[model samples]
Target: MQVKRFFAADMRQAMKLVRDELGADAAIIGNRRVAGGIELTAALDYPLQPAEPVKPNAALEAELRKTQAIIATAQARLSLPEGLTAKKDCQLFGERLDDFKNDFTGADHVANRVAEPAPEVVGPAPVAPHAYESASQDARGLDIVRSELHGLRELLETQLGSMAWSNMQQRQPNQAFLWRRLQRMGLPATVAHDLLAKVAGIAESQQAWRMLLAHFAQAVDVVRDDPMDEGGVIALVGPAGVGKTTTLSKLAARHVLQHGSQSIAIVSMDSFRIGAQEQLKTLGRILNVPIIPVGADQSLTQALAPLAQKKVVLIDTAGLPAADPAFRLQLEALASRGLRSKNYLALAATSQAQVLKAAWHSYKQCRLAGCVITKADEASTLGEVLGLAIGQRLPIAYFTDGPRIPDDLHRLRAHQLVSRAVSLQLAEEPSEDTMAAMFASFYNDLSRKVG
Candidate 1:
C-alpha cells in the first residue's frame, strides 16, 4: 500500500481528484477538516513494477486503458459530503411534501378513516408528529410482551455475567458452616467449591481443611494416559519399582497371547539390573516370547536386526527416575535410531498429587507420550491424580490395578477417568483426615527440612 496526500480548497474537490487519478477502491487512511477545506490521505495498491517501463505499445496501451477505466468508475461514486449538500430547498421539500399528506400522515388512505379521530392522522388532521408505530392490542395482551421482555433481559444479563466466573477456577468453598472461614481467607468461590468437591470425593472436606485439598487437587489435572499405538520400536520407561518391568510383561503378554510369540520380541535396556533380564526371560519362557538383552548402545543395532520381522518392537527400558540424567542418555540412543519412541511416565495411583507432579518433572527430560498409573486400588483420591495429569497435559494410557499381569491393566479414557474421579469425590462425607496428614507431611518433610 502506498499513500497519496491531497489538499484542495475543499474536501469534496480533493476526493474527486483522488477518484479521477488514483481510482476507486482506494482506502481512505485518514481525513481531517482544515481551516479552508480538508486534508485527506488515501492508500492505493497496484501490481509490482516491471524491471523497467515498456515503451508505448499494444501491451502498455492495454494497461493504461484498464487503469483509466478503474479511475472513471471511482469518480462516479465520490460526492460532496451531506452537510455540504444542505440548502433551504432540501428543508422545504420535507414540509411541503404533497400538502403535508405524506409528511407525517399515519393514515395512507384518507377516506378509510376511523370516526374516533383515527388516532390523530398526520396527513389529514396534522398529527403531533411524536407518536411512533406500534402493533394494536393482541389476544395474548401485555402478558406476551412482559414475558418476552423479561426473557430478553435475563438473556442479556447472563451474557454479561459470563465473565464473572473467569477468576473462580481455584476450587470452590463449602456451602455450610465452612463458608465463613472461606470468606475470611478471601478465596474465590469456584476454587473453594472444587476443593469441597475433592473433599466430598475423598470423604474428607471439613470446615477447616476443605480449601486445602481443593487447592491441591485443583492444582493437579490427571489425564487418561494413552501410549502411542503406531507400529515401530516402543519402550516402557520409568523409575525403579514403578512397575516398568511388569508393564512390559503385561504388554508383551498381550501381544503374544493375541498374536503368536514368534511375532514379537522384548528388548530389555536393563542389562545391569540383577535378575531383571532373567525375570523377563522367565516370563518369555512362560509366554514363549524371545527376549533380547542389549548390554551397550552398540548392541541395540544387533538386537534390533533379528527382530526386524516382528510386527511390534517392545523395548523394555531400564527403570531409572528421570532425575537420573543417564536415563535420558539411553533414551536419546533409542531416539538416535529411526525407531519411533514414546516414554510411559509410570506413576503409582496412591502417590500424592504433589509427588506425581514431581515425578513428571523428573521425567521432563524424556519425551513422555502418556502416563501409566499403578496401584490404583490402594487409593481413592483419584481426583488429585487426575488433576495432576490434566495440569501437565499428559495423557494416561493404561492403569494397573495390582500386580496381576493382563487382568489388572486397562487403558484409561478421559470421560471414564473424570467420571470415576467425580464419583470418588461425590462419595458421601469423603474423609479429610488424609488430606490434612498429607499436607502436613509435605510441609514438615520438605519445607521444614529445607528451610
Candidate 2:
C-alpha cells in the first residue's frame, strides 16, 4: 500500500485527480486545509498476486451489465454541457475569422460568411432529490437526542433539591401554633402544578418516579427563606406516634449533650398524651435541666417566660389528632403569647406523597419550618415524602433514622435526601413476582368484566 498527498482548492477537484491517478476504490485517509490549498491524504493498495477467478453466475452478469449501463449514461449526459459550450465558442471564433477573411473576397462572399450557427438543444438536468426530506430526518434525530438530554437534566435536578435551613427558634411556650401558621402561608400550589408537569411522563411507577422526584425538587426551589434563628419556645407538633415527642426529646438531649442541659430549658406543652409530659420530664431530669410544666394554653406563656436564661427553650408539645379543633386553638395561642415559633411537622418518609401533603395541611397553622424527616431507615421511598416536603418548601430541620438519641439525628441535607430518593425509586421498582402477580390479577379482572 502507498499513500499520496494531493493539493486542491476543493474536495471535488481533489477527488477527480485522485480517481484519475489511482482506481476508484483508493482509500481517503484524511483531509485538511494547508495555507492556500486543501490537503487530502489517500492510500492505494496493490495486491501481491491475483486470486483464482470465481465463475460469474447469471445474476452477477446481469448486475455487471446494469452497473456498466448506468455508468455509460452518466458519462454521456456529462459530455453535453461542455460540448454546447464548445459549439458556442467555435461559432463565435468562425464569425471573427469571417470578418477578416470576408474582406479578401468579392467572389465566394457567401462562403466567406460564417456558417449560420446551429441552435443548441438543451436537455433537462438529471432529477435531484429535494432538500426537505434529508433535513427533516436530521432534525428528527436531533430532537431525540435533545429529549434524552433534557430527561437526564430533570433526573439530576430532582435528585439534588433540599430544604431551606433556619437558625432561629421561638422562646415562648405557645410558639408551636405560630410556626404552623407560618408554614400554611408557604408557596402557592401553582408552583407544584407547573414544575411537576415538566418531569412527569406517562409511565408506570417504576419507570416514572425519578422524574417525579426531579420536578418535586424544582417545586421546592420556589419557596423563599428568611432568618429562622430567633430563640422562641417552639414545639414539635404532629399526629400521635409521628415521632414528635421523640424528636422533641432528641432536641433536648442534643441541647444538653452539646451545651449543658441548664443552657437549654425544657417546656412540657403536652398535657394530653398520657405520660407525654412525664417523658419530657424524665429526659429533662436525666440531663439535669428544668422542666417547666404547663397545663392550659395560657399557662405556656408563664412557663416559657422564666426560661430566658436558657440558650434554647425547647417545648415538647403533645401530638393530637390532626383534625382536633382544640389542638388548633392551642397552637394558635403562640401569637397571643407574642412569641415566634417554628412548628416542625415530624413525618415518616415511608408515607405516600398524598398522605404527606395531607399531614402537612392537617396542621396548616404551625408555620412548619419544613419537616423533620423521621424513620428514614424504615422507608424504601423517600422521594414521596421528600417530594412532599420540598413541594411544601418546608426545609427539613432534622433527619432521624433510628431510636439512638443524638447519634441518629442529623440536619436535613438536600443531596443526601435526593440520593435516598433515587435509591428508593430504584428499590420501589416491581420485581418479577410482582409483575406476574399484576398480570394475573389483571387477567382475572378482565375475565370477569368480559364475561
Candidate 3:
C-alpha cells in the first residue's frame, strides 16, 4: 500500500487534496486535528498491473473494513435522546460525513464510502455498499426520533399550560375572568397583563372591570383642542391606503366651513401617484381652496414660501412606503426647522395591530404631533388602534368614521373610544386551550419582568 499524509485548513480541503493527488480510490486510514486544521493519512494499494483492475491488498482492505465498521458504530451511536446537545451531535456527524465526500460521489452518497477520503471514489470497494446502507438507516432513524420528540414536546407544553390555567382559575377567579375578557376584546397580552397587574388587589369583579376601563381610557392621550382650529402648517403622513388624502381633504373642508377658504391652502406633495394631484385639485375646487402642486424636483421649503400668507397649509404627502427613498425625503422635508410643520399620522382603524404599530414607528421619525384615526366606520374593532394610541402615548386628534368630508370627522374623546372598543368585543370567549396558552405566555412574561 502507498501511504501519503495531506494537510489542509479543514477536512473537506484535506479530502479534496487526497482525491486530486492520489485519485478517488484513496482510503483515509487516520485523521487528527493539526495546528492549523486537519491532518489526514491516506493509503492506496500500489504496484498494480495496468492491464487488470487494481485490487487493494488484504491487510489494507481489512483495515479499511475495520474503519468502516467503526464509523458505522459511531453513526449508530448518534441516535441519542432528542435534545439540544443530541441534535447538535447529529448535525455535526452529518456535516463531517458530507465534508469527507467533498464532491467525490455527491451529497446523496454522504453516508456511502464510510472510511473513504473522497465523497465519490473512482471505484467503490466491496464493503462500501453495506456501509452506505447502514449509515443511511442510522440517519433516517435519528430523524424519526427527532420528529417524535418535537411532537412530544409540543404536546407536553399544551397539557402543562392547560393545567396551569385550571389552577389559576381556582386561586384567582376574578383575575382569570379579567384576563379572558381582555383577550376576548383583542387586547395585546402585554397591555392586558399590565392592566391586570395594576388592578391585582381589586377583588370585586364589577369594580375591577370598571377600574380596568377607567385605566384604559386614561391611557389614551388626546389633543386638548381640535387640531384644525389651531393649525399653522400641518402635514398628514402615513402608509398608503390609510386615507391621508381623504383626511387632508376633510381637515381642509372643516377649516373652510369654520374659517373662510382663503386662510387655508392644500399643498399637493404627492407627485408620484397618478391623478393624486388631480384628486386634490378636485377637492380644492369643491372646497374653493387653493391647490399648490409641488413637483418632484421642487423644494418643499420654496413651495411653502409662496404660501406663507396662508394660515393652515395642509401638505398632502405621497403615501409611499416608509423604506422608500421618496418617503424619507418627504419626512426630512416635513421635519425641517424652516417649515415648522406639525405632522399627524393618518392611521386606518381597520388595519391590524402590527400594521398600525409599523405605521406609527415609520412616521414617528418626523416627530408626530398626533394621529388621525381614519376608517373607523369600516373597522370591525377599535381595540388595536386604541392599544397603539395608549401604548405609544400618541395623542388622538380626530377620527373619521366615513368618507364624508366634514360630517364624518369627530374630535377625540377617550371614554367614547373605549366604549366603542368594548362594544366590538368578541361575542364568544376563546377556547380553554387558547386561553391556557395565552395565560402561560402572560405568566412567563410576568416572571421574566419580576426576575
Measured by TM-score, the strongest candidate is 3
Candidate 2 TM-score, true structure as reference: 0.47
TM-score of each: 0.46, 0.47, 0.66
The residue ranges of model 2 lying beyond 4 angstroms of the native Cα positions read: 1-230, 335-337, 426-451
Residue 283 CA displacement from its true place in model 1, Å: 0.9
Report the Cα RMSD per candidate. Answer: 27.6, 30.7, 17.2
Query: Per-residue lDDT of 26-78 in model 3, one digit per residue for the tens?
Result: 88776666698778888897544456543333443453344344445534544
Runs in model 1 deviating more than 4 A are: 1-229, 297-302, 321-325, 334-337, 422-451
lDDT of 2 by residue, 1-451 (tens): 9889889754445666789888798887766656865677888984446656643334323433443443344334323432243223223323322332232232123222222233455986453496456555544544443333333222222211100001011221122222222122222223423433453343354334456445445444311332123455666776667777777777777766655655677777677776787777677778898887776645667777778776677777766675777677667864353767666778887676556777788776756665778888887656566556655677677788888887887764465565555555442333332232222232233334444
Q: What TM-score would you give candidate 1 relative to the actual structure? A: 0.46
Error of 2 at 443 (Å): 25
Could you tell me how far off, in angstroms, the CA of residue 191 lies in candidate 2 after the best superposition?
A: 9.7
Give the range where candidate 1 is weakest over 10 consecutive residues by summed lDDT. Answer: 160-169
Give the candidate order by descending lDDT. 3, 1, 2
Candidate 3 global TM-score: 0.66
